[model samples]
Each structure stands twice: as C-alpha cells, then as structure tokens.
Target: MYGHRKNISDVRTPDRFSYPPSPSPSSYSTSSGKSTSGRSRVRGAARSVAGVFVACFTPPEEDTHHHSSSVYGGVSDTFSSTSDFSGASDSTDGRKRGTARGIYGTRNDSTHMKEPGSVKFTIAEIHYATKNFALALKVGQGGFGTVYKGQLQDGTLVAVKRAKKIMYDNSIGGEFQSEIQALSKVEHLNLVKCYGYLQHGEERIIVVEYVPNGTLREHLDCIKGDVLSFASRLDIAIDVAHAITYLHTYTDHPIIHRDIKSSNILLTEKLRAKVADFGFARLAADVESGQTHVSTQVKGTAGYLDPEYLRTYQLTEKSDVYSFGILLVELVTGRRPIEAKRELKERVTARWAMKKFTDGFAISVLDPKLEKSEANGLAIEKILELALQCVHSHRRNRPIMRRCAEVLWNIRKDYKELLD
Candidate 1:
C-alpha cells in the first residue's frame, strides 16, 4: 500500500577501493641483511593483512555502538563498545553497493517523505487563490454566503463559495455540510459539479466548476432589444426540467430543490441550463412514512412558490414543479415571476397565466417578441398547456418528473419537426 520508486541515476556508490601493490620484500630490512628477503616477504604479507583488518574494523568517530561479523568467514563476530553495525553490509562484490545514506538519507530511516501527489492545497493556498476574500471577485451573494471567482495556477477557473455564519448561528453550518454531501454525489449535464472544499478557521469554502454564461436572471434582464427566441426558451425549459427530474427521481433518494427560480438556474455559453444553489435542497426518505416535510417559515421566491406548500410548509418535489411552472411562464411571457405593478389579481404570473389559459386567452400571455408564424404559435400553445398542468394547485394532480420530461421532450420533437 505504501511504496516509492527511486531514480537509478540518483543512487550511486563509489567504485571498488583498490589497494596499493604490497611493498616489495626487498624494501624491508631487519637485523639480518643477507638474503633475508624470504623472511621479509613473509613479514610484508602479514603487514598487508593487518592493514586491511584495521581499515575494516575501524568504526567512525560518530558511532556509539558496535557489533560486527566477517562476510568472508560468516562466523567471525567482533563486538565493539562504541560502534553499531546493525545495518551495515559488505561491498566486496564488483556490483554497485547502495548505502542507506544515499538511498533514504537517515541511518535510522524513521522519517518518510510524502509522495508527490500527497500534498493537497493547504488552507493558505486556497485563501491566496481567492485573493484573501476580495470583494471585487464576488459573483453572487445569498443567505449561505458570498461566492467569489478564483483561478488556480494551472489557469483553471473555479467558483469558491465562502459560507457566512447567518446571525452568528452555528445551526446553519449543517446546511453547508449538506450542500457539500449532496453536490459531491450528484453529477449530470444539467447539474453543476463541485470541485472540492476548504474548511479553514471560521470559514468554509465550497469550490465548484465555473460556468461563464452567468445566471438566467442576468441574461434575461440585460439582453433587452433582442429577446431569446421561442426555440431557445423551450430548450432552456426542457433542460432545467430534466435537471429537476434527475434530482427528484433519478437518484437513490429523491431531492427536493426547495428554491428554483431564474436566479438559481445558470446558463452555459450555448445557453444550456444548469441547476445551481442547492442550499435549500433536501433528500426524501426511502420509506413512505419516513418522509417528514418541514412546515416552518416558507423559503422561496414569492411568485414562484407553491401557494399550498407555502401556506402549509409541506415541502415536496411538487413544490419544485410549481416553481418550474412559474419559470416556464417567465420564458413564454418575458415577465418576472411576480410583477407588482400588474393588477392585484395578476400578482403571481403562473396563477394569472393559468386563468388566462382556462379563459382561452393564453395567447395574450405569450411574449410579443415571438413571431406569429404558424409553427411558433402552435409550439407556444403546447408549451402553455404543459405549464398549466405543472402549476396545478393539488400536488397529487401535478405530473411526476418523468411525465414532465416526456411532455417537454415531445413538445420539442413536434416543434423541431414543424421547423423542418
């Protein structure tokens, strides 16, 4: 499980130590000067052997413990009080000899180096990457916290959401953890990808993949003269509907995106819709009775909220459907979910549009920018019918996500055929 690969070039040992030629026998002289060369030769051989033994047995000055064994005899054991040869090896062979110092550095070899990829970004690095929480790079702000745009050294862009403590209450901390858990598991073309997270000190930052096209709300508000085409609007609606379907029924536990509005829906360069902001999402229980819906202060945009769910606080997948119904109205009518300036009865556009559809005045609610071409008008009617079904007052009456997806897909198919 734990191992490392070392470079062969970095590991090298000294070549074999050649001993000087033994001194000639004639070079040594004793008491007898006459032809004692034979005796001198014998003495000279003894001296050479003694020199080799001394060099091998001598311990380094730093060594404090001693134990030795001869490699040649395999039986010779010499113990010295000041030296420890516990890990030393003989290198008489012609092949390379590797020293512990050259391989790993320390004689005791207690410390191990961390692998190359083992060092992840530290808290400080993430802080620096985000410009120490600069205000200018902030992309969005919400109840949870502010999200800032950051770039890594490798030129990859990321959105870092720093969770702000709501009213100094730690209870909201659970929301941050929940968002992390939910986003890490969910992956789809319409869902945003969570890159990673940084929990440092009192701040918790969630890193996510950055999409360039900004929020659907911004695009709708900024682009004035040239409105989104009918086909583009339908395409966006279908994409967002599919995203909600994945969260509600595709996953192991159904997720309720409590907050689904124009601001929460992000767009890619191609205008593909991606669902963002899961701060209010919750997982439904597997067992029927195990599910418990929160009936506290309602949390959603005013006009887009499901009136029944809002009053009762009985949150469910249907609540998201109701919001999507309002979004569809936005796409078709080119209006906000709640237009305060409109007549008091027309406060919630979804409700108003539904009434208009029943009164056979649905065409009046369609955006004027949409051309009156035969194909466009027919497509608009089909989409209006689907949107009306989505905003049904009874949660049970609303179609399931799968059914919604099928309806939208069929609408797209029919519209595309008409254009052809």
Candidate 2:
C-alpha cells in the first residue's frame, strides 16, 4: 500500500480534475532548435482533461547529487528485495546511486534505477482508482487479464489491466515487463499509449490511455445488425495497418502483433483504430537479420490463427499478416472467422472465402448488409484482393506490414477523393 499525503487544492469539484496549465507554444523549443509554434497549435486544440500531466525527466550524470522525491506522488510502499533492476546502464547506475526509488518506496541499489521516460505507477493508487477491482468497472476480459476503467485523483480517466493468475504466476514477470518495454519504445497516433505499470504483491497492473469508443468487435456486431460503411472500414484498416507498420519496420526491433483481430482493435471517440493487447506480441531479437521463425506454443484465436505458422510453430511478422487477413475477411463478409453454420469441412471462413474467390463467386460471399453501390463493390474487391494476398499459405508470399499499410492508405486516399 502507498503511504504518503499532500495538501489537495480546493479549486475544483470532485468530478472535475484540474491539471497544471501547459506551457505556451512560444515557450517551447525542440532539441533541433525548431520552435514548437506549429506543434503547439495542434496540441492546444486537444480537449484538456483535468489532473493529467505529461512530464519529461532527465537523469543526473555521475557523482551529481540528484535529490528527487519519489516518482509516484512521494508514496512509501514495500517491494520485493529480489526484484531485478537490470534495465539501467552502468552510467545511469553510477549517477543514480543511492538516490533512486523502486516500486512503492523500497530503496534499492542504483542499479535498479530506471532511465528517464520509463513509466512508474503506484499499486495503492491504482487499486483506489479502480475501486478494488470492482466488477462494475470491468470493461473486457482476455486471456491475460481483465481491463477496468479507472480515474486518478485528478479525474483523468485510464484503463488498468490486471494480469490474470496464470500469466502473473507462471511468467516470472517477463510478460508484464515485456509489454511495458515494448510499448514504451514505440509511439504512434494509432497505437494505444501506456502511461505506466505497477507490481504489488501478487498483482501486476498496466495503466494505459483510455479509449472511450469501445472495441472494434463490439461496434461491428453489438451496436446494430448492419455492416460498417466501406469508407469507415477502410479507414480502420488503414489506421491499424499504420500502427503495425510502425512496430515492424520503424522500430529498433521489429515487433509482431501475434493477435490481430477485431476484439483486439479498439476505437477512439473519433472512430480511429488503436491496436491493443500486446500480451501475445513479441519483438524480433535482431533488427538487421530478420527472424525467419520463432518456436512457441500454438497461441491465437481459432479462425484467426495462421495455418502454416500454427503447424510449424515457426513465427515471423508474416504470422501477423495472416491474422490481419482473416480480420479483413470478417470486415468485408460480416461473418465470424470460423462460422459454425457451414458444413463441417468448410466451417472456417477464410478457407471458404478463398474457395469462393477462386470460383469467381466473390460477390456471393460479400456481407449482405453492404449495399451494392459501385463504390462499395469496388472497395470490397480491392480489400478482398489484399486479404487474399495476405492469407496466401506461403509465409514468404505475404506482404510485409509496410506494403499492407501503403495499400490501405492508397485505398483510403482514393476513396476520399471520390467523396470530395
């Protein structure tokens, strides 16, 4: 539990959190000496939530008396002395020696001190925010854990995911650490932002920027018995593709989002897609020499699993591509990846769609809810072609994330021009 208290300002009501006013654009400058005038214009236009602040820090150099308060609101909490603090480099350790605070307020060797920019959340604070994991706050449940909606004392909303018993007890903390490390390294508009993480007793919690719109699966199926518009579907596809492209090609280590399904894709209030759920994701160990395969247990939703990769247990970025293809099929056809309505042999929608496409009966497989407009027909065909290319049985035959992103972007661009 956290042990700390400070005077609270009485400027706002309990429902309205208050954040410190941000610096003006004229007051900011980039490391490149560029003024942040244009950047500020965009940022200033965003809806400001009370009590949320994004603070950047710089660790002191060696032998510098770096006096700092506890990172999480000066809270004093106990952590296991055996916890690994290997994330810091030798130089950072030398500088932070005797001045760093571990999770809660447990003092540790400077070696356990993390570099600046790594997020740290207090376990007691999160428990208070989520009302001790109240059932009403539960948003979604997955293989790894249940996600709950929370609000900080400042009233900033967040989504906190508590790892399941199996993942927490069996993984030796690797799963949570891996997710924090991977998410911290990447930043994209279409990817969910991880605010911080905490480890308390047997509980592991990840704090992320909350998306209010809900999951793609829920919007597609729960809201109405109708398929999404071609343009909206294409936009979601493009956003997700861009996010994946950022992970695979732009990062220091290529990341494979092992699970790529509607349920894992979240929508924002603006309907923009944000890819979530990194429990099954993995970062390619070597960036220069791409991995051909990775050995792991067969993991993934039934219909979305890549047949070749599942059989071989050899994973690569292509595995993600294949899963995305199944998702695309679901978007276009309005059918579950594995529809039990079909004959026993043709139950899998991907296999059935492929067969239908080959027989020149693709239109018959299109979601009936989608109107037979010219634009809709063209969009379906274009997306179907891309999906087919992605789900090609041969892993090498699948396009990389960059290509997939480009294709989707171009489709969106063309559709926009048509509308204009």
| Cα lDDT tens digits for candidate 1, 62-140 | 3222221110101112212211111111211111112222211211111111221112355776777688878888776
**Which segments of candidate 1 are over 4 A away from where they belong?**
1-121, 165-168, 223-226, 288-297
Query: lDDT of each model, Cα atoms only?
Result: 0.56, 0.57
Superposed Cα deviation of residue 371, candidate 2 (Å) = 0.6
Kindly list the per-residue Cα lDDT of model 2 for residues 273-370, writing each as its tens digit: 88876655676534233324555544455556665655455557777888888888888777777666889535566656544543435565677766
Instruction: State the number of backbone clashes in model 2.
Output: 4
TM-score of each: 0.67, 0.68
Q: Name the runs in model 2 displaced over 4 angstroms.
A: 1-117, 165-167, 171-173, 224-227, 285-291, 344-346, 417-420
Scanning candidate 2 in windows of ten residues, the lowest lDDT window is: 50-59
